[model samples]
Each structure stands twice: as C-alpha cells, then as structure tokens.
Target: MPTISMTVNGKSVSGEAEGRTLLVSFLREELGLTGTHVGCDTSQCGACIVHVDGQSVKACTMFAAEAEGAQVTTIEGMANPDGSLGVIQQAFQDNHGLQCGFCTPGMVMTAADLLKNNPNPSEKEVREYLEGNLCRCTGYHNIVKSILAAAATMRGEQVAAE
Candidate 1:
C-alpha cells in the first residue's frame, strides 16, 4: 500500500491504498464519496470527473497514489459549507439540466472548473467545453442554458431576464 495524502473538499485526508487503486474507487469505497459516479468504467465516459489541484480530471483514469499531495474535489465537496447546492448545481436544477441524474455530478464538476477558468463563456464555448461530458437525457439544450445561467449568476448578473 502507498501512503497518499490530499485535501478533499476543504479537509485534509490521508490513507493507505494499493498502488493500482483508482482514485474513483478510493473516493467511493474508502472515503464514502459516492457523489462521484462511475457510469462507464472506461475513461471515455466523464462520469468519474473530479477536480485535482483545481483542474478537472477523470478519477477512473488515475490511481489514488498519483493524487498524493494534490487537492481533490468530488461532487459531494462542491456544495456550500451549509450543504446547500452550489450556484452551478442550482442552475442545473433551475434550468432542468438533468434528467436521469447519473451524469449530473460530473457535469456540474466540469462546469464548475470551466467557469473558474472562464467566468463568461459564450453559448458555443459552453457546449464545446461540455463535449466530453455525455448526457443521455435532456438533449443538452437546457444543460447549455444552465451553464450559461450559472456563469451569469457567478458574475452577479440576474438570471430572471435570461
């Protein structure tokens, strides 16, 4: 087992995991962070996406040991300290961006990272950035709207007019 340490959400965590243990498994099985879903074991599916060192990554594609000393943020960590959903999550809900909900976690995670890097993304940019995340429900129209709306909200703009 390899000793791995990282900050999850806002708390520091440390554990011993097998060298080959995927980050997704470590989060779900070891840390009980089930919000980061595993829709497809393959990396092709973005359901296992998370933030590592403030960047988005597919937990299924990385080993737990590799994340040592890195900051990790899973879907469960994206909410406010009081447990209320983040703005992006609220936007998804308000816009009905999710249907089956299986892909919502990853989508929200990716969207959060995207907005962090580009606070004011255009509609096309939102769609382009979300290309890696697949949603079998809602057909992505509302998803795009939700992302844009969330960006607006983050910028302190009113969504009621949009």
Candidate 2:
C-alpha cells in the first residue's frame, strides 16, 4: 500500500491505500469522513462527488493514488468555519431542497461547482447543471429553487422566502 497525502477539508491528511482504492473509500473508511457517500460504484449516480482542486469529480471514478497531492473538499467542508451551515446548505434548508437526503450532499457539491463558474444561474441552467445528480424524491423543482436561492444569497442579494 502506498501512503497518500492530500488536503481534505482544509486539513492535511495522509493514509495508506492500495492502488485500487477508491477516493470515496479512502475518505470514508480511511479518514472517517463519511459525508462523501458511495451511492453507485459505476459513477452514474453523483453521490460520491467531491471537489478535487476546486472542480467536482466523482470519487468513485478515481483511484486514491490519483488524488495524492490534490486538495479535496467533501460535504463536511461546505460548512462555515464557525460551524453554521454554508450559504448553499442554508439555502437548501430554507427552500426545502432535500427529501430523504441521500442526494443532498452530491447536489450541494455540484451546486458549489456550478456557482463557482456561474455565480448566477438561471432555472434552466441549474436544471441542466444538475442533470448528472439524481434525486428519487422531491422531483427536482425544489432543488432547482434551492440552488437559485443559494446563488442569490451568495451574490449578496436577499433570499426571498418561497
């Protein structure tokens, strides 16, 4: 096993992993960061999404060795330093974006990436951006609304409650 060192959630972490170890496995089992879930091993579901060097990637699609020196951000890192919900997370709660919650982490990760590139996304763009993330519950209208609200809040605008 090779020892991999990476910055996870703004903390330096290192662990021994085999070449075939998935990033999600390393995160969950090795580091005990279970927020980055393993929804589908095939990468079709975006539940394992995390930001590697600020871009969202499916953890299931990469080997731990590939992430060895990268900066990884999981759902655990999305919170404010003071331990409050991050803007995106608060927006989801305010807008009722999640149901069952299995898909919320991936949705939040993907939304963060989308907002990083496009600070203000239209409803269509939010829907298009989230096509890769699937939610078995909450038919997606609320998710789209939540992302939009988060974008608005992140842009320093008021989030009018729905």
| True-structure RMSD, every candidate | 1.2, 0.7
Name the lDDT value of residue 90 in candidate 2.
93
lDDT of 2 by residue, 1-162 (tens): 789999999999999999999999999999999988888788888989999999999999999889999999999999999999999999999989998899899999999999999998989999999988888899999999999999998899986585
State residue 46's C-alpha deviation in candidate 2, in Å: 0.4
Residue 15 of model 2, lDDT score: 99
TM-score against truth, every candidate: 0.96, 0.98
lDDT (Cα, tens digit) per residue for candidate 1, span 1-162 = 677888899789987799899999999988888999998889876899999999999999999999988899999988888999889999999998999999999999999999999999999999999877888988999999999999999999987944
Clashing pairs in 2: none
User: What do the candidate models score in CA lDDT, each in turn?
Assistant: 0.91, 0.93
Model 1 global lDDT (CA atoms, 0 to 1): 0.91
- Highest lDDT, which number? 2
